[model samples]
Target: MAKLELIRNFCIIAHIDHGKSTLADRLLELTGTVAKRDLQEQLLDGMDLERERGITIKSHPVRMEYAAGDGNTYELNLIDTPGHVDFAYEVSRSLGACEGALLLIDATQGVQAQTVANVNLAFKQNLKVIPVINKIDLPAANLELCYEQMEEVLALPREEALCVSGKTGEGVKELLEAVVSRIPHPELLDIPGTAALIFDSNYDTYRGVVNYVRVKNGTFRRGTRIRLFNNGIESEVKEVGFFSPEMRAADELTAGSVGYLLPNLKSPSDTKMGDTITDVKDPCPEPLPGFKEVRPMVFSGIYPIDTADYEQLKASMGKLQLNDAAFLYQAETSAALGFGFRCGFLGLLHMEIIQERLRREYNCDIIATYPSVIYNVYMKSGEMIPVDNPVFLPDPSGIERIEEPIINCHIMIPSEYIGDVMNLVMSKRGICTNTVSVDARHVIITAEIPMHEILIDFHDKLKSMTRGYGSMDYEPAGYRADKLVKLDILVNGEPVDAFSSIVHTDMAYGRGRQLAERLKDVIPPQMFQIAIQAAVGGKVIARESIRAMRKDVLAKCYGGDITRKRKLLEKQKEGKKRMKQIGQVNIPQEAFVAVLKATETNS
Candidate 1:
């Protein structure tokens, strides 16, 4: 085990695409953690979805040994965190395991919205903040502007900022030296019992639950009887190891060190993230302060494409829950979609990523319903209920009021696009509360927007209006009473629960019309005409009809009597009427996919 005094625990925090993963690659290279031939870009981002999208979805931890200029070998425990707002919970959990944070700022794009948001989170954790300006090798690098913004916007000292290029490894050695000298060592607790805080975890088919922990007070070794403080589940330690970017077995993990623990966990849910692990025989007097529970803001239903895969989908979701703490799900059944889970997420992107992972990692074919936000429904009988799915909404006559979630959104963009962005916000029923000029060219607009309104296309629209120069960060701003109504979609006069949503009263007509039109284009035509309608409180607000496919019955009677032709046509009509009475509209899988895409873009 390494000495406690010679260890430094820190993490890299920044905006998305600000070079957090690239910088991690350089650090791993300089420290010689991975061999040169095996090194690749984004060595920490092991997921295929992360690599394909060039974004970090999870926080990765690795231990590195660096021989410093001070003539001593120092052990650096670095946690690389995701930068997107949806993954802020991941960053917060990572910060709980570290003593300092390197606030990375791109020299070309200085002081974006997420940059400020991350800095605030670091400050809240009482972590040592080291400002590092990255991507200095780019042609568009503007060091002067970056320094000014760091001083003015972030309120960070300009003299302490270090400049480096993660791509070319310029000034990386100095940066490492600074990390060792500037960041303080983890405070060693004098408590007796063994305790370690689980910052993250994942599931393995063979090994079961693998927990990534930071040892707090005592040493943990193999074959020790450990118990989780939160769940009171006991298991014998099967293995103890360090992540050299990959798990390497170690004899034991000592105090002030970060490593992994493999315990005999029965199920993934038994090992909760942020739970304290302690020796069962000599338990710690009190558990450490764990992270706050993460509440998912957006909710949707995930159903298996084939009903036989329901059990497999449940197993896959349990494993996924072990990996992602922000995702929540509970079993629910829908008339149209059959058995499924109503999953909750932090945002739209989080929901999308989870679905993709379910499809790719677990090989589960799933279909997701339209996303919705949690709403407060007050009944006339003086009872209140929180509704995330339209199917659970109570009858309109019995409901007294409905309150929708609101968010405080901060958007940073170029000054020239302020007018366009403000207009867009107003169109979405959002009000711009304040605007501040960060520098001569950039402006930060603060607005209060309903959570459901901005769930799908708000970010995309902001980027387009600003020409890809805008960034946004948001937080929940409580809920407010609103004129909300549940909108239902019907196919051939049958309500489809998967397509139902709770929408504001003013936008109900237009949204319903758009959905009806999109569904009309996707649902295949049958022998009889199919009517698609959008209804609010049993009143049809919008309607569309798919014409039936006609058969050429007259081809055999070229010049026959007109009465015979009329009889043939009348017979065909009667057949169609009978089919319509007994026919069931087979809504294809593609129809759901097409309608989902339409709803996202139209919102």
Candidate 2:
């Protein structure tokens, strides 16, 4: 085997669609990690959604053998990380595992906000950063503009930025050489203790909890009994191996190398992202940094359309939690929807991905309420509890204090969109911090906005205002005290917990009206009229009436035209028997899906 000095360990970081994944694919093919004829696009994006959306959801590592200029072959470890802000935790954990980062910048779009964030994160980690201006093969590519932007924003030398196109492989060789020249070599840790950072993990049926870790010091072999420093859980290692990225595994790995271990850990709850693996012989004096617990900024209730599918829905959620630890759920029982989970997520994209994965992966149809925020309630006894569904909210007479989360948002758009975008933010309870010209064409606008205000169709609205030339990102910035109220949705004079939402008092008027109008289009006209109202306390701020059907006719019969009305009535009775009775109205499966779609579609 080649010595450790010739090895290179690093990861690629970029904004979404900035050609990070494409560059990884080309590097793999160039180094013989993947055969030329057996190439598949975006090989690192293993998830179906990631492939379909052209984004990376998980951090994937691959090992390749590259021939250096000295006519010697060296092992290259390349880690590919996701670009979206919702997956910041993932990006940070992945960043912690590598010694260096390759920051890819778009030649046409200079230095964007996300690129700056990634560069800053790498600097915080003390990782060597190499800036690569990608898509230089495009006819409109301006290398000088990108170099200047990197120098101004990232404070990197113009000579350090390598111009390359992942598509045509132009200047790729120089970029590879840059990695070896700039990125530092992994040090041989001499400590006797064994400790590794669990950057990410997944559960396997037979192997139990399989964790991916980068050993910072010492070594571990198969059959070694280890303890997790964070939770103090003990387990014996079933096996140890490294990612081949070629459908196989390596026998052993050491400090400064990435690998996986089967701890025989049964439930995925036992292992968490950012947890550490320590030595059975002599553990680390301090545990690797503990997990930074994430609270859901967005809340919503999920119920199966058919009440009989409730058990199936629960099973699907349990299976999903094995692979995804971010989803938070509570045993919630609603008067209208019965038993289901009140789920919480980090943001709108995170919520959408969980809902879509449930439907597509588990094959269960579900109804999700509008995403909102958690409200805090204090009773006469001075007891405080967080309320996700407004139905459980206490009467206003017993309230004490409330708080809401704030976020630091960055919006980059064309110069012409400055006025409309700022107006939209101001209307949505957003305060601008500053604005900077990224280049002559685009401006980076910074603002602080409440998390709830942007949960509903915010991306679409931003795109519309900017004429599809804007991109934005947000990160949680502590909590602020605020007066909040819960808006209850009553259907036919009864409140539905699944439809309730928490909102700031100032936004209650506009939000309630918007919600009532949305439900009016969703709940179909039935045998009896349905009332969709948004009520704060006992008074209703907004109301919309879904009128009952005005005409009823049997369009056709299965056989030839039947003059006897009895035969048609019999068929109608059979259909009604199959339908579900929700309150005074009977609805079919088709109607349920329509309402669910309507619940998601913004008015």
Please tell me which predicted candidate would have the highest lDDT against the true structure: 1
Each model's lDDT: 0.91, 0.79
Worst 10-residue lDDT window, candidate 2: 579-588
Tens-place lDDT per residue, model 1, 336-395, is 778999999988879989999999999999988888998999999999999999988999
Report the lDDT of model 2 for residue 524. 71
Off-target runs (Cα >4 Å) in candidate 1 are: 190-193, 306-312, 549-583
Q: In candidate 1, how many Å is residue 407 off?
A: 1.7
Model 1 reaches what TM-score against the true structure? 0.93
Best by TM-score: 1
